[model samples]
Target: MKHYYFFLVFLLFTSCQHFEKQVPSEKELLQKELKAINWKEVDEYPSFKDCDKLGNKTQRQQCFFEYLAQLIQEKLSIDTLSILYPELDTIEVKVTIFPNAKMKFEPQFPKDSVAYDTIKIDSILNARLVDFPKVNPAIKRGIPVKTQFILPVIIKVE
Candidate 1:
């Protein structure tokens, strides 16, 4: 009876040890989750106050882009770009919105287009693109993030 009790106790202790599992550390789990996330896409696009009430992600993004393009077109219409570069009708502007709601606009030019004065155009853009309406930064996993997109600004020279 004593030997049988000792064997039973030994079996119970060995079984309990086998059931013990090594839990992963917090840092390891975090790293794994980070790897699993897709950094290229955001849960929500950057938008303006006017666009916030729109339904669905696609509609909100469309409204934001259209409004921004319209504003840019209106602002630049009074500038001297149409007069300075009469042949240039369209300019691809790279717009970047930071997490803090700051914005930057840079005109993208092709490699061989040297006829237009790049410096003058940049100065004009910097000077003209100001005092824009309030913009909300993009959201990624419920956190604000920076976003960049190329906007084709149509310059109606006529």
Candidate 2:
């Protein structure tokens, strides 16, 4: 009887796999880690000099736009060119800043020959770049990122 009871207890313990813990695989753990991060959003927005003083994100964004507008307007004024032609079309400039704060500019103007020379525009932009202060690039996951901005240099016909 004692031998039979010992055998029965041993069998019961070995046959029951319900208490066994299944270890998770590395792939499963990696999937869970990826899911925890929100890929749609950035950790922080890009900053320009004097714009970072604002405490709120909304204000900071507004300041950034204002700063860029002022900087471009100050650099490329049509006051001298407007006198030559009674009317002039607006110029659209796209500036992209890399993570290292290096700038690349793309100026879009009328394809046809106009009063303003593209070469002069290039020289003006290049000259301003030499004096431009380094901007703080956007941040993602504690890493610096590239940012692009479009600035419209609007000149009134009047």
Candidate 3:
């Protein structure tokens, strides 16, 4: 009975260690997915600066809107003002996109004043690599074969 007990304990210990080891197929799949993603070619835009020179608050606000429109066109290849806010006679928008991880857009407002008349826009966008095959030899231990990513975008109207 003593010998049998020792053999059972040894078997259990070895099995636990085996479970802890990473499956070779999973590692390979992750490596391949990481390689397929292209990170160097994304577009970026410069910051808006014209608003600082304007004397009037309303003019400064208009300058902000115009700057945002130009940035969106040059950076994201999207004309947000023409497509989204054509009817508004005067408005301002600001958007920031983080490194495929997060993005935000907000209107520039005065330090001491509230923007009661301006329109606020906020949104979040997310994307991920998916649809990995279950039977691929590169996918070990039933691991999924995709990488996840996130991005954020914001727009403001005045």
Q: Who wins the lDDT comparison? A: 1
Cα lDDT tens digits for candidate 3, 55-121: 6656765564555455443443233443454443333334443333233445443465343334422
Model 3 TM-score is 0.23
Per-residue alpha-carbon lDDT of candidate 2 for residues 10-82, written as tens digits (9 for 90 to 100): 9999988877899999999999988998765556666787888889988887787777767666655644544
- Ranked candidates, highest TM-score first: 1, 2, 3
Model 2, residue 49: distance off in Å is 3.2
| Candidate closer to the true structure by TM-score (higher is better), 1 or 2 | 1
All candidates: CA RMSD (Å): 2.2, 5.0, 17.8
Q: Please list all clashing residue pairs in model 3, or write none if there are none.
A: 25-140, 26-140, 65-92, 103-152, 105-154
Clashes of each: 0, 0, 5
Which ranges of candidate 1 are over 4 A from the true structure? 1-12
TM-score pick, better of 2 and 3: 2
Best prediction by TM-score: 1
Better of 1 and 3 by lDDT: 1
- C-alpha lDDT score of every prediction, in listed order: 0.95, 0.72, 0.40
lDDT (C-alpha) at residue 99 in model 1 = 96
Off by over 4 Å in 2: 1-41, 78-86, 110-120, 155-158
Candidates 1 and 2 compared: the better one by lDDT is: 1
